[model samples]
Target: MPDAYSNIHLIVRWLHVIAGITWIGHLYFFNFVNVPLQGSLDDATKKAVNPQLMPRALWWFRWGAMITLLAGLTLFVLTYFYTPGAGFGATSLLMDADGITDRAMWILFGMLLGIIMWFNVWFVIWPIQKKLLTGKVPADQVPAARKKALLASRINTFLSGPMLFGMLAPAHYGTMSFGALLLALGLGVLAIWFSIKSSSRVGKPA
Candidate 1:
């Protein structure tokens, strides 16, 4: 039988995964599907589609992000901070001779990326999107606002791959060698850079 803390952790972890999928799924939909489709549409069509479609999608996207972040943080705290007897305590790891294992390093990197993504969603993307959707953005400012949101969303999509690796690899594969871990990090960074560059050119004319 599982203890109370274990039960809570399990619940929170499940919520985290579910909410993450919702959030990231919508994100991919926006970047991969909606954006291209919007580019193909004329202004009249965009005006018709966006007011109806975007608000509904953005509602799911932002709320999914919020729920995922909350659940993930709860799980992280329950797993690392509260579970001293489990040998996974963050304090114990920090106090050990090695002082923060490679696994912890990967988790930290993933968490940092998650934090940045959350910030971008709430502070940057959501605000501009709200302005555009509500017709508050001036005509001259619309393109800039759209571009800003697009870039931030693209960045999140780019980071999602490596962030998943960082969060999951440690659990599945245990502590990787410093060199191997660095190689993985390098690959992740390169992939994100490539994605950002490619996404930037996606709807542009040849």
Candidate 2:
């Protein structure tokens, strides 16, 4: 029933979802589980745990992000660029329209957030992490590097839910009004911020 392009889209979408799950799963683990655990550790324990644990986790986290981004981009091109009749093809990033459709606006927003998150992971998080993993970071710089990575990771976690909703909402719910879109974005950001703040406080001593 599906054409070759349709079949390919299906496969790429599947890969995108799987890779995204792996990437975000590890992301949440780092922000929620490992960060708190590390906070509770003494210097000696952190020195012991990080050397063994962080490299392995980083490997999965970085590659998962790469795969997800690639696959998602491919799917976006196929669905939007190639198949302009699709709901997402209503607007171009370079072109200004009098009004944009709900589906197009949501997809564009999601893609923009995804791009920023990917950039943070690769350009920001991974580079700082590599310095730490290789011990090339100066003793004085370690805290700054760790904080940079943690903040970026927390920001990605904050963006993930809204990004996912933006990607899926058009297909599942058709289209949302502009007001509804704003409300969704606002609530999503607020909820994620609260979640990150709450999780960060875990494992802290009174």
Each candidate's lDDT (Cα)? 0.80, 0.81
Over 97-184, each residue of candidate 1 has an lDDT whose tens digit, in order, gives: 8777666676777788888888989999999999999889999988899999999998898788777777786577557577766766
> Candidate 1 clashing pairs?
none
Off by more than 4 A, model 2? 83-100, 200-206
Worst 10 residues of 2 by lDDT: 87-96
List model 2 lDDT by residue over 13-106, tens digit each.
9999999999989998887777767767898988888899988999999999999999988877776566534544523532336455566667
Prediction 1 global C-alpha lDDT: 0.80
Steric clash pairs (candidate 2): none
Error of 2 at 39 (Å): 0.9
Best-fitting candidate, scored by lDDT: 2
Say which candidate scores most in TM-score: 1
Candidate 1, residue 116: Cα displacement in angstroms equals: 0.3
Superposing all C-alpha atoms, what RMSD in Å does each candidate have to the true structure? 3.8, 4.0
